[model samples]
Target: MAELDKECLFCKIIQGTVPSYTVFENDDVKAFLDLSQVNPGHTLMVPKKHIINLLDYTPEDARRYLQYLPAIANAIKEFDTNITGMNITTNNGASANQVVMHSHVHFIPRFEGDGLKLATRNNAEKYTSADYEKIATKIKEQF
Candidate 1:
């Protein structure tokens, strides 16, 4: 947990002010159905404490949240038996299209050609193995 904004919607949910159709909850994490489902079993996972973005999270918080992610994804798969793939994503600032101020991960179950189209224009470059190694090394430095 870090400094929190009491006005954040997810914080309100954590405080039991706003209602949620929660699928899972632990001492520090909450997983619930997304109000606007991209697919039948769309779920949102959040820390009970407020965090604004992935980059803002502490390593300990990340480790704790990650421990629950697989379980949540497995539950979604079990709920929708026919799911073939899944995408776990988190958005950051408004420019990145994050609608909520609270940090959350979206679990989107994917079917073959589910007609989902993501931004491709900025993803034009094909990186080499060396490039990936460099990027990975840089991120590891921060950790």
Candidate 2:
């Protein structure tokens, strides 16, 4: 848990000031149907706290929210048996398509022929083992 961003849409939703079609809620997590239904049962789950973006979450905050993600996804799947698969995603920053500053996870339920396209560029073959190691080492340095 952290400070509250009063102007943030999710914070307002959590406070019960802004109406949302809630699907799941506990002490610290709240999930609801996404306004933009990417699929039959598109949902968005967010921490009740006002942390901004994935990088802002404390380890405990991340743990609490992640523990419920599967349950929410499974519930959505069960609600719509047509849900054959799902795309669980969290965009970190604006460059990664994070329109809202608040940290949230999108649970996009997929059905047969649900023509939803996620931006997935296949550039695996373009990078060599050396290139991979270089990126990995750079990332590992932070730890």
lDDT per model vs. reference: 0.85, 0.88
Q: Which ten residues in a row have the lowest lDDT in candidate 1?
A: 116-125
Worst 10 residues of 2 by lDDT: 1-10
Tens-digit lDDT string for candidate 2 (7-33): 998988988889999999988889988
Off by over 4 Å in 1: 1-4, 122-143
**After TM-score superposition, what is the CA distance of residue 71 in candidate 2 from its true location, in Å?**
0.8
List CA RMSD, all candidates.
Answer: 3.2, 1.5
Per-residue CA lDDT of model 1 for 1-143, tens digit only, reads: 45557789888777778898899999878898899999888899988777888878889988877689999999998886679989899899998889998899999998787887666475427888888899999999996
Clashes of each: 0, 0
